[model samples]
Target: MPRTVPRLVSAIAALATVAVLAGCSTAPSRPLEGYAGEPKGVDAPASSAGGASWTAWLEDGTQFAIVLYGSSTCPPKVQNVAATADDTITATLAPAPGGICTHDIVPHTTVFSTPERITKTAEVKVVMPDTTLTLPTRQG
Candidate 1:
């Protein structure tokens, strides 16, 4: 029976440790999860693409990229994306992480997994806060 005290104390200690660790959380990661990267030609001004923003399907319809143009150092990012219809997508930008950013406009790409509801083979309209881009169906 005396041994039960030590077991009980050990259980409580383990639980406390777990609770403390669970409460401790690291700062949010800078890069969006799933995928984020600066695609090639990022050096070119976004206008070179004849637009300030665009979207594309990547890796055989598994993921999509949202490209936004602004300060290279503090460009807007895609916080989340959803398919409201088989041929439509909505992209929500992450609130700008306020900070000093380069005045120059450059392209930054943020990729998100294609929502299951999206029909990648169809012309998908990406609706954003700024504009709607009609992305032609991806060619095999």
Candidate 2:
């Protein structure tokens, strides 16, 4: 009985130590939030080339960035700063893929402003190609 007491105590202590280590090593997870932006509207023109636009408004205390996914050919660009307020900045569309081309805008990073104020409206433009062609074209 005396030997059994020491063994039981050691077993409990080992389990407690394992529990403490497991709790210490576990990581905490947080929910992902969307970017701070208000959509003004989207614009697309005909003729398979030329004018296209995308606009958005940013809110206060939010940081954001612009990302463009495009083919190896023509790429998108962030145009002018359309509007700027005390706590906001607006950007206009530049040019990007059009004529059956697609692109994705991803927010890669964010920068915080002082006093937690809004900053930047976003804009993007689509530019069409003269003609469509497949990639990795084989030469005859």
Candidate 3:
């Protein structure tokens, strides 16, 4: 009987310790406003052609940075930008010379300002050579 009492008390103490530690664990933080996902769909054909490969957030809510990375013999330029009714902004880019591009990866970055501020759940669409990526903005 004496041995059983000590064992039971030790078991209760261990459980209490675990409960306290679990309660002290931190919760996950919310994402910052205007935060977007990393660049995607930058593979194969797009990598062979110059295009807007990825996008990132800027300090200002209405501005974003677009990265053009690929292997176009000539530099690429932004041709058109359109905003759809579904809160998605699309930007199209093509090579300047319109010929066979090199196989080397060239990178360029440019900043674009939107007519209005992008809210938490807005989407950004990047139209590349053979693909389009739609990314959602961070919610916080």
Candidate 4:
């Protein structure tokens, strides 16, 4: 009976360890916000009025913008922003620094101007860790 008890305890410990490791392996959840659809081709220039910063325009004329809310523990770094030949606006956002951020939602603006005018059929795509947001262009 003594040997059986020890074996049972060992099995339980192994199961507990597996459960803890499985929980730790789960990926962190990042909730996304802002519009994720067709962009209304409004001629209004980018402004910080709504806490959204204009990122840029794609070769096909799609507008890109970043909508910021909540306190970021680290500033969101822009790694790359470019217009591809296929008329898609591609952007990569770097991970923020490690720090404590407030719970308040703060809106910030970023504007980008391109020599090329907006195209009626352009699309915007923002890529991040485990997340992708695609915004299509809509006729005004």
Can you write out model 4's per-residue Cα lDDT over 74-95, one digit (the tens) per residue? 4344444444423343455546
lDDT per model, in order? 0.68, 0.32, 0.52, 0.45
Which candidate ranks first by lDDT, i.e. highest? Answer: 1
Model 4 bad stretches (over 4 Å): 1-63, 72-77, 114-122, 138-140
Q: List the residue pairs that clash in candidate 3.
A: 73-101
As for lDDT, the candidate ahead, 2 or 4, is 4
State the lDDT of candidate 2 residue by residue for 37-129, as single tens digits: 222232222321332222222233232233322333444544433112233334333555566643443222112221122222222221212
Following a full C-alpha superposition, what root-mean-square deviation does model 1 have from the true structure? 10.9
All candidates' TM-scores? 0.64, 0.24, 0.47, 0.39
Q: Which candidate model has the greater TM-score, 3 or 4?
A: 3
Model 3: residues with Cα > 4 Å off, grouped in runs: 1-52, 98-101, 127-129
